[model samples]
Target: MASALCCRARSVSSPILSSARIRRRLPLVGAFCVISLGLSNLCPSLSFKTGCAQSLPFVPLFKSKFSSQSQAKSSGSIRMASESNTVPSIVVYVTVPNKEEGKKLAESLVREKLAACVNRVPGIESVYQWQGEVQTDAEELLIIKTRESLLEALKEHVKANHPYDVPEVIALPITGGSTAYLEWLKNSTRD
Candidate 1:
């Protein structure tokens, strides 16, 4: 086993093996030292790799088990709650085939109070598989900001106005934001 490892190391271009490459071959440096020491007694040539392996420090391959509460208490850190009870406002992303449709949809959503703001991002190129065929087209992307409660109505509005059979309407939650902006976003949307 030691002969094969030594041969593999020697066969490579570099005369001296790097510490990273050595660590990859042998998980524990100490275990490799013991095995190589025993093999060196049988064959004197294996002693060089044993000397090289001992110089590199052992790196932990896995993370240690720890509790967040205990770690916080020890370090004098304040840990925030992982989950909150209040429903947050979110940004809805929608893609339309053209700018006209995008503008119409954006205006309608904001006018209806389904969204507080709608930003039209033009010249978006989309490539996706549709009905078992790969298709590519220039598109306009709408970034709509609104409350979670108005999501159903917003979807219905888009469905009614959208030309495509299956439109891209997806909501992503806003975990946190500027306090004033969040407050304004909440106030601007429908009750």
Candidate 2:
């Protein structure tokens, strides 16, 4: 059965199975060869030459998908998270002393292309310890959306511009959201 599949695979010469397509599908072919033929060893090479699988040790099909180094060595045939076309987005939480400060920071961030959108929530009460005493104060919250890669720059900008000595700059990864909004967020922020 494995030999028949291999023979059929080898005999396939359609225009649809061009070199680029073959390279893109090599992992699937390698997986089929390993599972169907019970082959313990196969080549890591992406070539489709006859008898190539039997000549070398098996290469895990999913390795390159998870490892950047492996993906780099594989000539980028497989796409990883870092190599994705869409930029990874993040949500940042920053608390400001008042609405005036919040607006100031939000405007600056958007104007500088560090943040896509900055939603200001007013009249929030924060209770925290400061200078060996518990303090309570009303604060404004700035919810910022931007690219994950811009986190450090955003944080630095906040630290430099924010009124607080230690400004609240908390970041959270955006797992999923509207595709259009995410794309807009990606486009709004710097690379």
Candidate 3:
């Protein structure tokens, strides 16, 4: 029975993953989703239902509708194994002026519990367009890992502290990560 259920989940998961919407957001989300639905999408004949199974690693596929992380968190939008006690799974990469600024920003985020850790990678060369001309500058990058719940506050912290006219505040999702590490990430950043 357990093996059959795994097979069922794999079948439903394959197509649901091939869906048009999920591809763009983050394939990591798709990966977590595969674990969650556990072949539930294979049965389209079943009536559409409400609620989520993110806690069970076998939820209905239709519930994976929203593209934004906020929406996902609100509705049990993502799933993991029963053993999963992972914290949050979002990593935001930001560019700042210098090591001094980077460290300051990192310190602030940690102080506020907005991010677990903000690693300052210095001496990065960035090339981009500004005011109609292409430009290159040596910039420091702040790699911050935190829960999705803390992203908004993190952004606010960055905006207030960063010295750039428009700092790079792009974030990427962590789909399949160390279960223990994820739990640490959540615990470290909690306010």
Which candidate number would show the highest lDDT if scored against the true structure? Answer: 2
* Candidate 1 structure quality by residue, lDDT tens digits, 20-89: 4764767576576655554544444434553554444531211123333344543442112113322378
Clashing pairs in 3: 9-38, 9-39, 36-57, 36-58
- Candidate 1: the clashing residue pairs are none
Which of 1 and 2 is ahead in lDDT? 2
The parts of candidate 1 lying over 4 Å away from their true place are 1-87
Task: Give per-residue lDDT, candidate 2, residue 137.
Answer: 97
lDDT of 2 by residue, 1-191 (tens): 54555456667877765555655676786677665433222223443444654554544442333355544645543223335455888899999999899999999999999999999999999999999999999999999999999999999999999999999999998765566677788888888
| Candidate 1, poorest ten consecutive residues by summed lDDT | 77-86
lDDT of 3 by residue, 43-111 (tens): 333323434544554353344333243444533423541247775468999998788888888898888
Model 1 clash count equals: 0
TM-score of each: 0.56, 0.56, 0.57
The positional error of residue 25 in candidate 3, measured at the CA in angstroms, is 50
Shift in Å, residue 169, candidate 2: 0.5
